[model samples]
Target chain A: GAGVSQSPSNKVTEKGKDVELRCDPISGHTALYWYRQSLGQGLEFLIYFQGNSAPDKSGLPSDRFSAERTGGSVSTLTIQRTQQEDSAVYLCASSPRQYQETQYFGPGTRLLVL
Target chain B: GESVGLHLPTLSVQEGDNSIINCAYSNSASDYFIWYKQESGKGPQFIIDIRSNMDKRQGQRVTVLLNKTVKHLSLQIAATQPGDSAVYFCAETAPLNAGNMLTFGGGTRLMVKP
Candidate 1:
């Protein structure tokens, strides 16, 4: 079966620019999540989407960070006015359903804000 | 204010040897815990999970042990092989208004010597 997939495996941008990272969950997954990982650090939760409910933006660090999942399938994470501190690997994961413990992940999109 | 952390940042073991990775989490309210394996340039891949009600769970050559009393979690691999070499992370699910979000620990890098 096809696993989760992400686009633009690597991205380099200048500070103050905006970038979008894309994620495609498995065929039937109903839940998607985005996280950020700094070098040699743990993953920091960004946002989550389940079914048609409002996305969870609690983990988002600031208003500049936003995400959208359309048709309950694909998700895009956008960081506006990126800062050097925002340089990290953006990862996406998905589960078969809400509250499911196991999450399948995609190869992350590494973002470097210079 | 809750956080998850690992005692060791790196571990080296010979092939065929058993490996143990330890993690500590501060959120007692967490009910579900998971372990993930990630290689360079890749996102995390789920290994196994255990609920707070269970003290231990096993899958294939891997075992996850949780000690709620001490808020400790450990992943043990029996007869580990070179393929097991990677960064291992322990994550706990924190309840959110929208659902459960994972809080990950700083990963422990495992180097397997053939």
Candidate 2:
């Protein structure tokens, strides 16, 4: 079966620019999550979406970070006015259902803000 | 805020030998734990998971052990191989009522020598 997939494996942009990272979760998956991994750091939870429930944005570092899942499938993570500190790998994961322990991850999109 | 952390930043082991990675989480309320492996340029891949009710679980060549008393978790790989070299992370999550977000540890870089 096809696993999670992300677009733009690598992205280099200037500071203050905006970038959108896409994620396609596996078919039938109802839970989706977005995470950020800084160089040599652990994964940081960003946002989560489950079915039609309200998304969890508590982990988002700032208001510039936001994500939306349309039709309960694909998700897009948008970072407005990107900053140098936002230069990191944005990863997406999904599970079969909410509260599922195992999450399948995508290849990720590496973003570099100059 | 409570967080998960790894006991060691790096671990080196000879191929064919057993390898063990340790983690500690501060949230005692967390009931679910998972182990993930990430290569140099990829997102995390789920290896195995264990729930609070059970102390251990095994999958293929990987085994996950949980100690609720000490808030400790460990991943043991049998006959470690070069392909197993990667950054291993342990994550913990509360129950559905509390929250579904996973708190990941810093991660342990496993270096396998053939």
Candidate 3:
């Protein structure tokens, strides 16, 4: 792809339902990151992936929130038992070769847990 | 902990005036910094970046200044315009072994009034 790509630009789900958001990073990018942006709030770090490593999952908000990257290309973020507080925009980014290198962002997926 | 996407303190500037956005980073080891601009419903776009080795860097109508001594960073926009109204984010980069990863600061919103 020409840039980082995220899917399902907008979503509205019932409370307690599970939702999965997808991300397709730029080709050959080695670092991928996930962030949550709430209304009028700062972007919150959610998770990070470096190549095929264990990933830096320190930012995951809870047990119900999880993410995974396959073959170092595509990724998915799953939120189980969605809550109203979970409504926000999920942003994904990826950098070429290194982590601190420039990270290109995606359009993001906006989720609304009703 | 390093983060990005600020709660967004806002700065309003009249058209043809200049706007300055400020940030403070927590990591002393972070030497590389980049500024991003995000419009409503859009992902952030890279504005400018400065290396720790340099105190300043300039681009078309935009400049980024780094004060490592104070752990502060600022973005200056010359001749502000209504199109410049957007949220600005400052990010710091840390060397992580073979890669460098960015930790973002809270964002600041710039409103250019015509």
Q: Pick the candidate with the highest DockQ.
A: 1
TM-score of chain A of 3: 0.96
Q: Give the per-residue lDDT digits (tens) of candidate 1, residues B1-114.
A: 888999999999999999999999999888889999999889999999999989999999999999999999999999999999999999988554245678899999999999
Best by lDDT: 2
Better candidate by TM-score, 1 or 2: 2
Docking quality (DockQ) for each candidate = 0.74, 0.72, 0.49
What ranking emerges by lDDT with the best candidate at the front?
2, 1, 3
What does TM-score give for chain A of every model?
0.97, 0.97, 0.96
Task: Write candidate 2's Cα lDDT for B2-79 as tens digits.
Answer: 899999999999999999999999888899999999999999988999889999999999999999999999999999
Query: What lDDT would candidate 1 get against the real structure?
Result: 0.91
Q: Candidate 3, residue B18: CA error in Å? A: 1.8
Please give the TM-score for the first chain of candidate 1: 0.97
DockQ-wise, the better of 1 and 3 is 1
Clashing pairs in 3: A43-B5, A99-B100, A100-B100, A100-B101, B3-B104, B4-B104, B6-B106, B6-B107
Q: Which residue pairs show collisions in model 2?
A: none
- Tell me each candidate's RMSD, in Å, in order: 1.3, 1.3, 2.4
Best TM-score goes to which candidate?
A: 2
Pick by lDDT: 2 or 3, better one: 2
- Candidate 2 chain A vs. true chain A: TM-score? 0.97
